[model samples]
Target: MHASAHVDTFARDHLPPPGQWPGLHFDLPELRYPARLNAAAELLGGGVPERPVFRTPAGPPWTYGELRARVDRLAHVLTGELGVVPGNRVLLRGPTTPWLAACWLAVLKAGAIAVTVLAQQRPRELRTMCAIARVGHALCDVRSVGDLAGAGIPGLRIAVYGGDAPDDLLNRRADAGPFPAVDTAADDVALIAFTSGTTGRPKGCLHFHQDVLAIADTFSRHVLAPRADDVFAGSPPLGFTFGLGGLLVFPMRAGASALLLEQAGPRQLLAAIAAHRVSVLFNAPTAYRAMLGGLDGHDVSSLRRCVSAGENLPEATWRAWHERTGLRLINGIGATELLHVFLSAADERIRPGTTGVPVPGWRARVQDGNGDPVPDGRPGLLAVRGPVGCRYLADPRQREYVRDGWNVTGDTYVRETDGYFRYVARADDMIVSAGYNIAGPEVEDALLRHPDVVEAAVVGRPDEARGRVVVAFAVLRPGARPDAEALRAFLTAELAPYKCPREILFLDALPRTATGKLQRFLLRARGDTGVDTDGDQQ
Candidate 1:
């Protein structure tokens, strides 16, 4: 792992650091591509037309040449017909369609920052994001055009991609082209990605010209490692960094193929992979588990890598997948603040349950309550620092994120002796009872080990005196009926009395974000945490 090992790679060196650390190898020069064009410009430099760049469910396959052609036409229309001036924010909203991809590239090339808003978001959420981004225009699907029309944002121009365009706006036309690339600096703000604000309101995370350098060098280098001929496909939408990177940037950057499905469910994902012969697979653990049964009829041997992130990777889920597929599921954690997971490992020798070491160009540490360094193998707040940093637009949360320069992610983890960090759940997700502080995930992991459990989410519920008590939500596999009394008896034997949930709530499904993360904040709203407290000493 010498610094010189990655010296010649295009994306390996990016950060401001100069000399390399042989102890933990990193190269600053190779970490980024030169900030010539926006994210779209850097990705489409690969000169090929027939080579697949993006594949949609209903339309023709967009190759490197075809994607670039479409982008050129779209940028031409956006500049000529739509009058999209530079620095103007365009709210690119929709599913992962070819039109959206073309629109995203057009917005960036038009010298406007592309603001991708997910379709799953409520109207209120859309209004909030649009207002914050100062959105001058919106490129959405046909279904959402009307919803956004009545959103009450004044004079916000709306253009439906592939659907009917507004009267003044023009769709794909004969009179558009001769588009020129905008000269953008490395520090120019490229995107304002939103982190799910479970605690309160969503915060805007800004990424500059050099940001994609880290996404490709660090994330792509470590996780997917896609090649030119390889075909990429995944379950996440283009709006999510998971989908944007996994399905779009990573593949197109290397001149690989991307299958962009507008409807990315368990069935569509499997069918697309088998139909398109997708090489790289990226989705949540729940998606992987749900698709396990569907793999029997599909020839999915094209899958080279399967990346799991956005939630804690339970041990049972990981093992079950391995037993079924004989392929390793790469696990990592990413926050919108950091843009993506700065830490991940793809190669073998990966420990079963540990989130592997930090990827190149990033550094992480576990810190104490006072932000001091914590001892190894002890759980503490996870703090990270690298090329990307958090910037909450006009929000005081920025003060909470930056501490002595490092971004203090709201995650609790323990760095084991081998340098791997084991995720213990979010810091707020910890439960305290009597005196000892117990992590809800620990109990959930114990329950998942019971074999009958298919999915689990542990949360701290309200308690009368001890503040909050442990509560468990369990989703059992079909044909296995493990009742509350029997499961509680089993958990009591394995866990400390105070740590075990006083009650278990059964559910067929859990609330989750589009990226496949459990929305534990919902559990808190449900007020499910209560202790038995049957005359037991407190």
Candidate 2:
């Protein structure tokens, strides 16, 4: 391995051991990039002059030329005023706003690695991220400034944005002449995106300058196929990699514009789509299901593509959306480690229930525990390798993520003879009962088919006779109340008796992370306690 030519080698030095890294293969010509590359320049500089790039509800749209000028001024402020040298880590904390996007680009433009943190994060999570990334400077939203300051990270210099502070990002040096984009190696660390840490501590997933463009080139260009006049909108916060690529990189790569929404719930997202005539949407399956309830009032005719990731999309959700809107829902499975979508189906090739085949530049297969490929039609662990893979920031878990040069995504899937991948469940979400292995998601999907069930989650609980029995937690639609016996009968008719939940617990709402991911671990904890609050025990 060659030494990095970066000014600050903190990120490079802290990377996991070389032997733990998954083998990277960039066989595609489009995947190959120059040794020296700047992601900010590659993403934003190629936009058509005077074309709209970003738009919001409150303010006028920002054209490419105007955005470039702001990026240059911020780059100057980062390097000149904040003393951000090459490879230094700069933390960005904010909701999905135009200024936050600009700040992310400015960090890369100034040759610093951008560390994105979610706005909903508390002081403890903030301190952990700052400590892990060794963040030197921060550009935070005004509302989060007090919390960040209270975190008390050592030697962290903070600059507030969207406020009256003198050093606010909006009031920064606007007259600074165009600052040249930093010339950094293609493999240089450009962004350190922290994982959602649902299991434990958040780990930083390091992405290179070229890796940023590879996602847009592969998934966005080949799958979503955005047009120059298209408008992209979604609910994901910019802190998540799914949001970063869908809202910023993909749109910019195609010379399209993005609608930035600070708070995008089901109603807000639908309203924005109609108001802006958005053509592309990126959100979770849960959101798509929520959006279906009020589709009669909103005109979403302009929506040409709908991409769902961050979780497996149930067949019921996919069919419901398509039935309502007459638009095929694109289903994909991506990981923070891999940067963006590696497995997906788009356009006419999409299969409603499946996650589809690997993207053009990637290879995916179902593998046994021994890292050997499993026969088609057999459920096994999902492994993928491509131009992009996991590169953890000095964590021992890297060894678990990369095995035999393939990135082992902790998912179970079945590879059909037709070459499509059908998701079974997360590797840990499999339930073993009475010598029969069952995927909890399968039962959950069956429950979702019931009209009264708004959401469902299934897990296995210890049972003396069966070893483990299937248990379900459900949220019902307003004014709809189905008791445990009725739901049990429904599941028994839809699935095998062994797969039917022995107990059904109804809750007002299911616990979810900020990104709309179901917190199954919390549900599992509830199951372990054998407590039924709704008194639906059978």
True lDDT of residue 336, candidate 1: 81
TM-score of each: 0.89, 0.98
CA deviation > 4 Å runs, candidate 1: 1-26, 32-37, 164-176, 479-482, 528-538
What is the C-alpha local distance difference test score of candidate 2?
0.89
Ten-residue stretch with the least lDDT total in model 1: 1-10
Measured on C-alpha atoms, candidate 1 has an lDDT of 0.73
How do the residues 1-538 of candidate 2 rate in per-residue lDDT, one tens digit apiece? 3345479999888877877788887877888888888899987877897899999988899998888888889888888777889999999998888889999999998889999888988899999989988998999999878889999899999988899868787787655688788888888899999988476998899998988999998999888888999999999988999999999999999999999999899899999999999999999998999899989889999999999999989999999999999999999999999999999998889988899999989999999999999999999999999988899998888989999889999999999999999999999989999999989989989999999987899998888988889989998889986588998898889998889988899888888887778889888888888656463332
User: lDDT of all the models against the reference?
Assistant: 0.73, 0.89
- Count of backbone clashes for each model? 11, 0
Q: 178-296, model 1: which lDDT tens digit per residue?
A: 46777766556666787765546787776665675567777786566777878777788877877777877787777787888878788988888878888888888778877876778
lDDT value, residue 95 of candidate 2:
85
